[model samples]
Target: MPTGPKHQRFVFVEHNEEGQACGYEEDCRCMIGEDHDADASDESLNVNDAADIWLSKGMDEDYMFGFSEAQLRRAAGLS
Candidate 1:
């Protein structure tokens, strides 16, 4: 029942022109510089079920999943 490498998850907040969150301040708190809450019931899910979740400010379509480093490199066109 080995799960292999563990993937890290992050949450990105959308800010307004003045660098303020649009809405849901309580639910959508900042994830940076803080340890992820393990007891938290609600959590964000990665796009397309990607192993390594990356919260970005803008649109990103490069997220992918692979079982190994070589597979990830190949998927990202780094091979």
Candidate 2:
């Protein structure tokens, strides 16, 4: 968990050696160069869960993401 000011925390995004999104981090919730276990999923945070987290981060009530809550949760493998 990050412990800085609301907008000062660094959001880490895993990128490939080419500096592009690895494209697999979202699925396995694993960092770059790490082996993904087929049955080792522990990151099952759903949309409501995400909303709570975002709220904790000072997100406004009307704030939205590039994707809908369902879509975001689905991408997080919680659908």
Candidate 3:
């Protein structure tokens, strides 16, 4: 079983008053909840073979949730 402190994958999009997407965010955190481990690594996210948060807030979700043909097929269980 995985033994590292638990982390939750996240994705959020902020909307403005005009109903347009204004910000996007994604990351892995050591469960920022009522309970947490002090030793948990804040840099739990890995990108490009390195421990890092792939994208910070303020970007659009499209880049992270792109609809490539391969991804679509995988999502539809066609692969």
Candidate 4:
């Protein structure tokens, strides 16, 4: 099991009043009702609300893998 601070992944977007897309962000922290101070814009939303919004985007597939426990130790010169 993973033991650490729980984190929810989400995406944010900024759009104009004409219902046209302007910009978007992947992996936004304001998914679970978090603060929007980091990205003070006219609009903000979650990643799951694709159908609800005029335009929405998805995050890219992260092909990079995380380091193993042993690999971490070796890199720290503890092995």
Tens digits of per-residue lDDT, candidate 2, 1-79, equal 3232222222334333332332322322223223333464765444455555655556544543323555444444555
Model 3 per-residue lDDT tens digits across residues 1-79: 3344445543434333332334444444443542344566665322221111112323334433423334333433455
* TM-score top scorer: 2
The stretch of ten residues in a row with the least summed lDDT in candidate 4 is 55-64
Better of 1 and 3 by lDDT: 1
What are the C-alpha RMSDs, in order, of all predicted structures?
15.2, 13.5, 13.3, 18.6
Clashing pairs in 3: none
Tens-digit per-residue lDDT, 1-79, candidate 1: 3332334445444433332323332332334324456665574432222323322312234443223344333333455
Each prediction's Cα lDDT score?
A: 0.36, 0.41, 0.36, 0.35
Alpha-carbon deviation at 31 in model 3, angstroms = 39
**Clashes within 3 Å, all models in order:** 0, 0, 0, 0
* Candidate 1 local distance difference test against the native: 0.36
- Count: clashes, candidate 3: 0
- Model 4 misplaced stretches (Cα beyond 4 Å): 1-65
Of candidates 4 and 1, the better by TM-score: 1
lDDT of 2: 0.41
lDDT tens string, model 4, 1-77? 43333444333243333424454444433343444456666663422232222112222223111223333334334
Candidate 1, pairs of clashing residues: none
